[model samples]
Target: MKPYNFRRNPKPLTPNDIENGKNFNEVLKAAGKPPLITPSALKWMGIGLSSLAVLLGLYFGLSNNTEPETSFVQPLGPVPFTSALINPEKDTLLHLSTGSTIFIPAFSVVNKDGTPSKGPVEIKYREFRNVGDILLAGIPMTFDSNEARYHFESSGMFELLAFSGDNPLMVAPGKNITVRMASLNSKDSYNQYYLDTIAKNWVPLGKDNKLFYTGDSVEVGNLKGQNLSKENWEPIKPVVLNPKAQQFRIEVDPKEFPEIAVFGETIFEVVPSEIAYDPATAELPWSDVSIERTAEKDYFLISFSGNGQTLKILARPVVSKSNYVKEMARYEELYKNYLRLEKLQAQSGPTAILEKELSRYKALENQRVADMERAAFVEGRNNTNKSVVYSVFSVQQFGIFNSDYPLKLPNARILQPVFAFENGKQIPATQYFLAEMGRNNLYTFKGGDKIQFDSEVSNLLVVLLNDGSVGLFPASEFGKIPSHAREYKFVLEKVETSELSSKKILSMFNI
Candidate 1:
């Protein structure tokens, strides 16, 4: 039939044509429209698909930008043993040099009856030599509270004495040694003034020899330890001799001694020039006198040999007293002023100007007290050698206060014993559980009971309880403890088994 209708019919439809037709119908049904395929139609379809892809890409990119990124980090391992100790290098202690040590001797004072004396006995270093005011001439000695004993650069002398008002009793009279000889040159009229000054202040040796010659020899000894009121002397009897007896005299020139210058009644000390001794003659030989004590009389006998003959002379030592009544009255007045100023200072409120005035008054008062103490020696000739020492028991160190917190122990390993309550009784932790928990001999707190701590020195006290809690206290507060309620007890919380396991793994890896 197709051959007969070749003109109208295209060669008979093949299997490919039928399959194409089925595909065309399926595409048309799915699209709900007639399916058309052309070069222009393909270009429009590709452009639509590109726009949709770009829109989808932009939507996803914007959503990603708004959302926060998440990251995962591994946990830290167990702490190292070296990082957990308290370092000694960080301690705040007053460290002394190696091999340095301080030592103080024990001292005490006693009365005449060998009982403890109830008075303040001051011990100080001797500052000046003979005749000078000690307080005015010296500096006050300063000392550290931590010092055990005073350091001695050389063998030093100390004055130990107790003041009885402004008077001083000759307890241990220290010695004052001097070998002085000088010559004085004065005007004729000034000589009488000098003599009067000497007679008023010093004790003269001879009865008729008050006006001494130029070449007189004078000897004086033991002027210290004298009374303050009266002169005590054992008079010497004049020597009586026969007509054939040779006469010899040891004369001292008044000009060859300590001199005095006077204007009206006021006298002043004058330094003198060099001295000279008159040559001894056969008639008046200068012999060394042998001092002999006699039971017949209350005086000393001096014997000598001159011109091939034996001779003797009488001698006596005088103990003179100096008057300090006026000086003592002045010191008492100064002490009253000092007390007044001190009371005023205590009563006044704190102010810079007032404080400055108080300070000035205090300094003046202290100087007056020191001067009074010094004048005691000069007024009474009371030496300090006879005084006894006394013992003083006082605090050697100062305490520290708490409130300084968060103490860290870097190198110190302080472990305490751990206790547990079982059957209402305190019991120590078992070794098995301690090993399982990875603990040492550390004390643990378990709720009840009071704890007391006494610190002997400045130190940091670290306490770690079983519940993984910690506490810190300063050395000062340790003594005042029981300061908290129920004394001090440890409280701790148990850690989870999983945490413990993780810790164990970290520890294993760490080693």
Candidate 2:
């Protein structure tokens, strides 16, 4: 009746049992006595099962929850949109920090239901100016025309969006918004295009009008006088005494001609001209006699009118023989004082007093030829500073718009370009971009595709690697490639994701 110890002394298998394939556990179960496991052993088994479950949960959880793939068209850096609140019922003129202007007419924005948008509307705008801006914005510069693909050489580009509260708005039918985009390129070679987001293409929107600044003309003659040196300053000549000529003393108002008032007593001597002045006309108690300066130096146009008759004659200011010697001494003293005051003013820098003094004597200097030449020079200079060229266009929809011209890609091609680091380590790239120095466009090529570029033009090669790092083959290296090479290996400078930035990318290409 003793219990069989299966671990120590188990029953020997019979020939029949062996033929029936009964193992040790089956034999023990059939004998009505099963092996027993202790609580400690069960506890250890539960812990082992739990550990396996936790390990499996971690593995599947990590496999299910992974970071999303980054968008290829996403901007490289932060480009914040400028927002403005505008009343949709009233005409609004929005001015951006870039000196561009947008004219939104009344009732231009409509709701999705085709009803006029009311109350305040939000306008979000941004501009792309330079190559860095365009690259950071991730805007596609390629255009398709007549079954051929061309790149867009942008002059200026902008994005405009409208919203009402949390809902998006659209342009009202038959209404359009006018945009005057401040452009750096003043040339009229660019045309307008509207980006179709859903279609992912740009549609032609006709030619853009390039408007230049037209303001008041700058008077170069006045500026020249104010900018003259003391050595170039010319003093007024002393009045000549012609006693033999028909001369008479006349009092000129000091306020009317302060320049003439500087001279002590002014005598008017009639110059011989086609029209002779009658002495009887001088004593006829003239109703009105006016004196004004003529084109000639020291010459005045004198007109006398009375009893419905008018007489016009050229007269020159003169001094009497008796007063000549005294006036000459007075002139020398005044001239010396004028020179001393001018030197003092020049030392004090440009001031209202100096400008007034210079302007008062500008009429006395004979500088017509010099003034004309300076005027042309100054006009050209002021055109750059005082005026801005604008690319004017009207949009019926709110989206990205560009003033651009389509340019064809280069005919030269290199098939299956192998991109590698400078140390000859091969790296895989997702996309490649070729940017010419003068063109505003960026030509994109897929990996393992043919790379086309102009050899004569300065070209910059940029590759987006599979690991999100940037690789740069600068314009200098691009120029060194031989024209006859069919297969090309691009030696690039690696730019890690942490160091990838708009400024760094621009500097690599020396933009």
Candidate 3:
């Protein structure tokens, strides 16, 4: 049977002489089968060529991502202080600082003159916990501190976003700055490495002291006892992100158990496993020491900024080493006595009154559990302040005692300005101010400020400048801060901690 044949319509072409076309085909056929090629071989060749093209394209495309196609012409101005860019993951970006910061997620970093620098911050994107991933994107970094501005030239492949909020210094212009690599890779540093490449930069705070180098800004100042390689080569330390961003007015919550944190010196401020337990014994302050005990169930901390401005999550519910058993041992022993005495009701018969007494013993046992719950120092996640809470210290500033713990200072009316921030964007509902008892002191300060003497409690002297500027001069640079500094910034001075004599209480019992 003849099958119906179908053919696609041929595309129109310039008509050629049939005779000439046949002659050409005949001549070619006569030429030893014309070295015909197989369709499979042709297909493989096409595929190989295509794969090679893609590989070459990707190599050059990534390498030349940010590089200018044009020759090294006149360099472009720096990215504008106000301009910003973010990575594909939507992390905020930054650049040179005029002394402020911003939190908007941006994409490309434009120059001050409105142009992007040549070259794709060509870093591969990937991420690793101990190490970051490759194929990361780009990130803009900018900050201003002291008198210098720092700019970072970087790719955000695995990079993290530094813009958490408003920072005036990050957006401010006017300083020499350089971004280093060590600030980006330390286990404690801020940025995340997406894949293989790291893109970043740093801007210094002063004109003459702008950052002169950068590689992977490590931010190594906070890592103590850590043997980290500087940018993998140089023996330099990374600087803190916001070493001196001051907040004029701030607030805090004292009842809020603070989540342990360390800014410029340590990795973690609190280690839950290191929690110390009180003695594991129960005493009635009398001769009664017998009691039953129970096992501790769980433990945690709920720290809050003063005034409930912020609620921070601390330790989760975890098994904690506790003395709950030893302390409650007395309850069991007393209850047993009451029960044993009941069996004697037929013999000596004191069960009724004894049961009542036994009840009291049981009550005490229950009290221990209540005490354990009350033993919590901080609040819980259930109760959080919806206001902004700026971290504050108990004392304005606390320094060293004698030589090592010495707090250095220059002539200024104010000795310590601990709770100060530059731009706004703070934890709401928190408040702060310089606390000068009964009266405020005036002072002045300048570069090269140092300590003269060291005394922990001796008050500093205030020096009036010829220009009407007041300065605080540390009388003893080696003095210790007020004792009992537990968290952000509160301390108990010797005077505050001193107990006073009581008379009414002494007479309450007719003593």
For each candidate, give its TM-score against the true structure.
Answer: 0.16, 0.52, 0.15
> Which 10 consecutive positions of candidate 3 have the poorest summed lDDT?
397-406
Q: Which stretches of candidate 1 lie over 4 Å from their true place?
A: 1-114, 117-323, 342-417, 420-511
TM-score, cand. 1 vs. native: 0.16
Steric overlap count per candidate: 26, 0, 157
Alpha-carbon lDDT, every model? 0.24, 0.64, 0.22
Give lDDT: candidate 3, residue 363. Answer: 55
RMSD per candidate (Å) reads 46.5, 35.0, 32.3
C-alpha lDDT of candidate 1 relative to the true structure:
0.24
For candidate 2, report its TM-score. 0.52
Q: Determine which window of 10 residues in candidate 1 has minimal summed lDDT.
A: 398-407
Could you arrange the candidates by lDDT from highest to lowest?
2, 1, 3
Best by TM-score: 2
Candidate 2 clashing pairs, residues 3+ apart or interchain: none
Per-residue lDDT of 185 in model 1: 12
Error of 1 at 161 (Å): 23
- Stretch of 10 with least lDDT, candidate 2: 40-49
